[model samples]
Target: MKMNRTLFLITLLSTFAMQGQDSLVSNIQEVTQVADTVKKVPQRYKVEGVAAVVGDYVVLDSDIDKGYLEFQQQGVSTEDITRCQLLGKLMEDKLYLHQAVQDSIVVGDAEINPEVDQLMQYLTAEIGSEEKLLAFYRKNTLPELRSELFEARKSLKLAGRMQAKVVENVEITPEEVREFFFAIPEDERPVFSAEVAVAQIVVEPEITKEAKQTAIDRLNEMRQDILENGVSFATKAGLYSEDGSKTRGGLIEGVKRNSQYVKEFKDQAFSLLEGEISEPFETQFGFHILKVDKIRGQEVDVRHILVYPEVPQSSIDAAREKIETVRKAIVDSTITFKNAAIQYSEEEDTRNNGGQLVNPVTYDTWFDLTKMDPELSAKVYNLKPGEVSKIFVERDRTGKASFKIYTVTDRKEEHPAEYVTDYERIKELALKEKQIRAIEDWQNKQIKETYVNVNEDYQECEFSSDWVKTSN
Candidate 1:
């Protein structure tokens, strides 16, 4: 994504707006102490001076340091760009953030709370716990940190809206696409290789029998403690659950009723009443004893201790057999492909959707033979519509391999770009460019009126827009 500080500021503001005023101020004071509290940081990434200030907000020395460190981590070379490009991008954020407050954009509790939770989760993963994160940020607690970030979040969101407003309705015509295509240099014209869309019948690896037994034994031990020793399941989840949802006492958010989780995990979890414990059952993650915490209508919250079994050849052999059975069932007239998916597929994201791959570019439902990755598209190009290919190992964007079956439903090789093929996308792109121009124009005007003071240290630097007054 394009990096803009204006968006960052709005988001930061909105995030804090949800948090009460007094607490939010306290959080800012604490955040300012971030430099003071940094007893230890990554050795390679030393602090850099604060490059610029956007209005009242002081850009911190650590901000530039962290930015440099991340760029280095990502292997981005700064050899090509002059200091002008860097300053322009960095300082443009201040302009956007200032506009954000004037526009009165606010992000409320419903919006910020989830972000706070995600932030907490990330911090917990980074620093070991919420307490450590608080210490690192020089804050008293999570609530304090969240409150300070609320305003920033708002500032960021408003900046985005302003950007959208700048060119939201701009359109690119057929001529524009051709113009863009022709604008590419002959040497730089990228090879538009054939991409394919493939559907999947995924199967997870099976855990060892010994692993299952061990998990059962451990869960039984935990269950015994819960029953006899008065230990709470939530506490057990915090201490023992291996799933990412462990910290929230086994809470899983946004689960769909139509979706499928591991059958073993689901069957036992769904069967148990509230506050009841499930006997150990085996799933892809391994042997788990489930503690059913709450049921909200169609959803249930369960904390489970998953003890993964070391994979034995026999375990793979077993899992392969079970998945192949479903594959066979699909091949035969025994079950409709959709029915089999709904009944037997463990891949939750695509199970109810009938394992159909949706196009990210177009919201169109049909899988195209041409737009897929070279490796996948190569395999699926030969298959006819409605015919299912055999189980193939394909890596997702993350490079995780799982069992898959591709069914080609659509094949389009060439066409004059129509509204269906490219109009909306082209229009959206054009509109955004227009908006950016509009925003830049508006920003230029704003700078003329608004008091902008840059330290004389940057007088030689040619920013995107020149600052009005110089500060010592």
Candidate 2:
């Protein structure tokens, strides 16, 4: 399905955060738009209908409309932003960038390089190749385009920081939550599904100890050869690297900051300096040796050759047996499920946090069972609170299947949400309200503080979604 910008961003962010590792992956197209009023635009990149020019930045009409269409395709509702509203947004972005520069809010290479890679990939994919990219966009190479994207990275990071500031301090109380619930009428209150809380002892059966060692040995060999021969990593990567980016040689793609990563992969990739190669390393995906090619701003580019650790039948049996042992321990109450999770679970996020299940959509400890994976929902929803589940295997979208044993830590049946019954949920609503209010407060603060000047044409334009009012 075509995803909206917001949804796409959320998905991308979630993926990177969950894995917390490093390796180059695929990228999607990224673009921005705004409204401009200037007749003779000075910028080389123009897609008609001048949106707004914020100092050195210009928001084009195409940016907004393209995003609008994308949102529409995704069934997301966005009340059409008038040209002026778009301009306001453009101005806001520029303002954020301006503030970021003043504060020296530098982005990490980890964040910027992946984004550059994604954009570059998309551009090359669209226009044909590296040569075509230069010919069509009048850009010499990827680095020049990456420089342009660096500015975008700054704006995005600043906006994110600003947003965090708005919601970071806001807190919701149980009483405030009740008020929020009551504020919504019965018909308006969104109904929830029967939800389940599930815990898991995960087993990724991709790597056998022997195969894993082999991968390590190979990487070590490759690393030694690179040092001995001084073979360019990118040239080596293109010719013989086993990683997915073999065609591009080992050049790291541009990425957004705090974006998805393989937990081990990301950490190591971000830690390296320019022109350095990492010792052979291993992640859930497999073993790799990395060579850092370049660093721009806070983003880094690298190439790697991955050697997969062979999956063994005995290894699967061993993993399952371990899971069963944990299950039996839970059954006997020798350990609490959460504690067992913390002790034995390999899944990073939950294992570190006592195995509390979080809803992917709401990020809540609770979830709507209906929205869960069919196998998981069926297993988890049937269990009462504090029940452990049998080992079951599930496949990701990529057809990569893994085994996991789940424990239902919590369960809630269908019921009307009320002040007393859904106290926490109500509180969450109140907190969300506070967040919205905080945003408005912040926007008003910005308007009051920043040098904002609305165009004369937009002076009388009525905005339906006004966060702050100006004496225009």
Candidate 3:
């Protein structure tokens, strides 16, 4: 399916405060338009017309018509959707943007620039290249598209900031959670699947001394080639750098001296004269050779080549054995699992949290079995509470191999959610609902107070909100 790139863009651009159902509804409105595929401008909408005016900003009919076509192209059924509803949404967005300006809410270039780059990357990849994308949009260059969308992007950020401000202090209590859970009809209550809470101790496979030296030697050779054999640093970086920016010839721009770069990297980079290449140096990731490209005050642009060392089979075996020992000690009760994790586990994310694995989806320790990693699920499927599994090797998302031991801390069979067993889940739901209500209330008041005007063309459309009645 050609994803509704426009809808995706709208959602990505706006950071609404109301989550769950309310957020979904707001998002739908934000992107709604006519029920037609966007192609060459239709004769009806070709004659430019005003849709609505909210405060200082005006919604153009062309905007809604374009969004409608883009929506249909994304495979969305706009059969029941209307232009009036779409215009209402556009006006709502403008209302938030107007208030944002009045309140001086600002989104800096640093924040928006990355989002723009990411969007460009996504569109370029989807359309098959920069050239294809430019042709599709009838533009000469990528920057032209960016410039055309810049205002829409700015308004999105502004509306997001305003929404965030409205619900910044909203919260829900335990009693409210209980009340909300009981209020749902019995058949409508959430049903939870079998879940497990597990803890783990992880040990990363280490790169051996020989492996480290080999990487350093390779980087040294590259540096020597650049400095003595007249090899271009950018060419060498493109050929050898392991970093993501290697595609851009290993070039890094707008780097500040005090940024989070490693001390060794920063010190060497700042000391180099423009166009000077550094001798190879080692950091946690690997060996690197850097060349200064430009300097402006405290910021310096540079290019680099990085080579990562491979962990050997012997290193993997050693790490596995080390974790096995820790698991044995825990099984023997020589030390508590939490204490052993704190003292010995190399995995930083879970070590301090007593090795407890939190579900990324729920942000809780309990995970639905179906949502767990298949290997992890198999290992713990039949384990009783407090039972520890044998040591196992697995690769993380980044493809880094590691050894780990799993302990089933708790388990619960599939059942309807109850007050005692699902208090946390209920509390989370209640809190989200409370926040949504707060946002709704705030939006209503803002709409009532804001100066809004709907054109006669859209005055007869049934809108969810009283936008037409409230418009001055």
| TM-score of candidate 1 on Cα atoms, chains taken together | 0.52
Which order, best to worst by TM-score? 3, 2, 1
Residue 449, model 2: lDDT of 55
The list of candidate 3 runs beyond 4 A from truth reads 1-162, 173-195, 227-232, 256-278, 291-300, 320-344, 358-384, 388-393, 396-398, 412-424, 445-462, 466-472
Lowest summed lDDT over 10 consecutive residues: which window, candidate 1?
21-30
Question: Tens digits of per-residue lDDT for model 1 on 111-148?
Answer: 44445544455556546777777876679965587676
> Which ten-residue region of model 2 has the weakest summed lDDT?
29-38
- Taken over the whole model, the C-alpha lDDT of each candidate is 0.57, 0.61, 0.73
Give the per-residue lDDT of model 2 (tens digit) for 125-144: 55667787776545776667
lDDT accuracy of residue 347 in candidate 1: 84
User: Comparing 1 and 2 by TM-score, which wins?
Assistant: 2
Candidate with top lDDT is: 3
Q: At residue 225, what lDDT does model 3 achieve?
A: 82
